[model samples]
Target: MFTFEIFREEVITCYKEKKQQHKLYSQLENPSPGNLRNLCLIIFSNGLSKEDTQTFNEFFNPLNQSNELETSINRFDLDKLRPLRNFILGKAKNPKDEVVKLLAILVDFQPRPYENWKKSNSTTVIENDNVESGEKDSSEIEAEIPVNTEQAITALNDANSLKSNSKSKYLVVTLGLVLLLGVFLFIKYGTLQKQCMYWNNDRYIAVDCKEKIPGSEVIALDEHKLNNFRRITRPDTLSNKDVSRVWYSKVNNSVEFFTEPGHHPLYDKPLKAVTAYILNQHALEIKN
Candidate 1:
């Protein structure tokens, strides 16, 4: 966890100091831990645009909006982020605006247990280091368990469990919690492929979901089809493929795709027809 309160303060300080917007941008261009990059982008996208909104719009396109959304949600208080939220909301005249999805994902985020531990122990040496020397720091090993992997695995597989082990009395509850949380989050959110849907021209279309926002709509594609799309487009290994963007409308309570490229013929229709087409075509892939 970052010193979110301090970061919020710094952001406010920068704005209040009347630093040139580009100067602020330059300073924020290289923030520590990388997660702060999104906050900076949001600030620039919202604040700096006042001078030349059209140019700003032209320079920072929809694809960049999705890229900012891909960044991880950090531990900032909703109260502190209110200014940014309000700024974004005020600009997003359309409820289906792509920025709305960015805000939604940030608000809906749930930090993991391991993330909590890391934040809590950020300054501690044990938390930052690996047990490479086959030795566990007493502070890190809070529970009386075999610290070695071989011993731990044997203890876990044994019918009697660690009870039969003369070396330790109990399992590492903290370790178990970390592993469980890691696995759960991985299964729940990590396996999603590089697929996303975007709203465009009164309808939706399939696109590269850089942000990988969950529950976004997508054109039904076979594993084979996706591989082919990836091969043909060959998105920058660093970035997502340049494709149309998507949004989630809180009003409609459904994923909205941009009807830009008409990635699928059925997605190019007007609202009603597009909705019906998606319901009919991607029915199997649609989430309940």
Candidate 2:
């Protein structure tokens, strides 16, 4: 009545038990050829009556090695048990009864089945817990990255502050040196000064502190454009005419250089007034 797959499963289970018990030995409770029939009959007897079932079950029940002797079945002995399985269905009324008989015989000899189930399920739970712990470790690793970045940014800000302060000091020193040089040039060669005034109606030059209009075809120059020439000793040579000279130095906030000794003359154009302006300057070496 049983399929080939069901019969194969029983045989495999029987073989695994035989491996554990050591094939070379025989157990005390293991039924020999004389009692093998009697053992099958006992399990088969369960459906027959209550009293017979109890006595038979206690007779052939497999015992654990700690408290009882070991029994083993080789390939030949296990094959021998297969024939007894057929007898179990001999008087059964239906296929369902036959299947029930097979399951009862296979499982009856297994002791402490609940203990095995509990251990297997507990091992699965431990494996699942290990996976969750790995996820927690990964999140902690991600957390440290931002902490490392913040520390780097703090160090960079400190370094930039130090550099900016140093640059400010250099700019202050350079500006102070430039102002000092301009003052020194002003005092040395700026001894002569004069002013030529021009009215809205006409222009004139002051001769011995007297304003006079030119009676000759002499060009006029303004104070704004008369500072280009710096090395002329005589003012008359600039325009080939009689010119006058004056020194407005030691006066009211005034300095000048365009002056002639004889008469104040005019030029064809207001050009470079070549006089000494202290053009050459000595360089100073910076000591580190």
Candidate 3:
């Protein structure tokens, strides 16, 4: 009994109640299966408990790569989603009650009736009405019925079979073309790897090597030298000049040092003034 419109309304209501960002909400205003899937992923990632999140990742990750439910609503396989519904309900407390309702709608989703079926039924009703109204001789009508019925049924069956075969062929050809296009794009663009770092005046800028800055002298990319850059803790014994010579930036638990004051080549964080700490306790000295 569930319809796509019902699912859409439920999701839109949930989004509003949660006060999710306007940009994402705008995307849901005219939802496609692709965008709806993306929104569901965001919801799952943000709403689920740690244990539930892990289970969701394990169950849904493989399906994400497949073309299982990315197409038209009629082709959607609700059986694939039933196990997820069961798992969500099995939990002691349902933290994601909204997700449970959405899954239920998907599992119960009914495809709309085909137009041909409606036309066939309408035609049958008209024929029956004419017979009942005594518009023709009863015997004559009965004699004509068997031949007309047989021919109509045979023609309908043939038309349906041809339609089914044509659709199958179209799907196969479309898939092949898509596959070919994907491979072509990968081969062309994927090979040109973006340079991650470029050396600037006395320091390296953590930017794409291809980035253009007018009048800036950029040296050749040296990944080995960049990788070797490490933070050296300033010793209190050192002069102010020595401390100024090295720039530092804290990266997680560790601090990274550069030869000159600039942003980190990897982290992109602005370098800070060096602090007085004994080199022996903090880091090993790296010779320039």
Predicted structure with the largest lDDT when compared to the true one: 3
Which pairs clash in model 3?
none
- Stretches of candidate 3 above 4 Å error? 1-162, 165-173, 176-184, 187-288
Q: Which residue ranges in model 1 land beyond 4 Å of their true spot?
A: 1-106, 109-171, 185-267, 270-288
lDDT of 3: 0.46
Give me the overall lDDT of model 2.
0.36
Query: Which stretches in model 2 have alpha-carbon errors above 4 Å?
Result: 1-11, 14-111, 148-288
User: For each candidate, how many residue pairs have backbone atoms clashing (under 3 Å)?
Assistant: 10, 20, 0
Q: TM-scores across all candidates?
A: 0.21, 0.21, 0.21
Q: What's model 1's TM-score?
A: 0.21
Q: Give one digit per residue, the lDDT tens place, for model 3 in 162-234.
A: 5566568679989999999999998756744544445444344545557776766444444434543444444
**True-vs-predicted CA distance for residue 64, candidate 3, Å:** 32
Model 3 lDDT at residue 269: 87
Q: Report how far residue 51 has shifted in candidate 2, in Å.
A: 22
The candidate with the higher lDDT, 2 or 3, is: 3
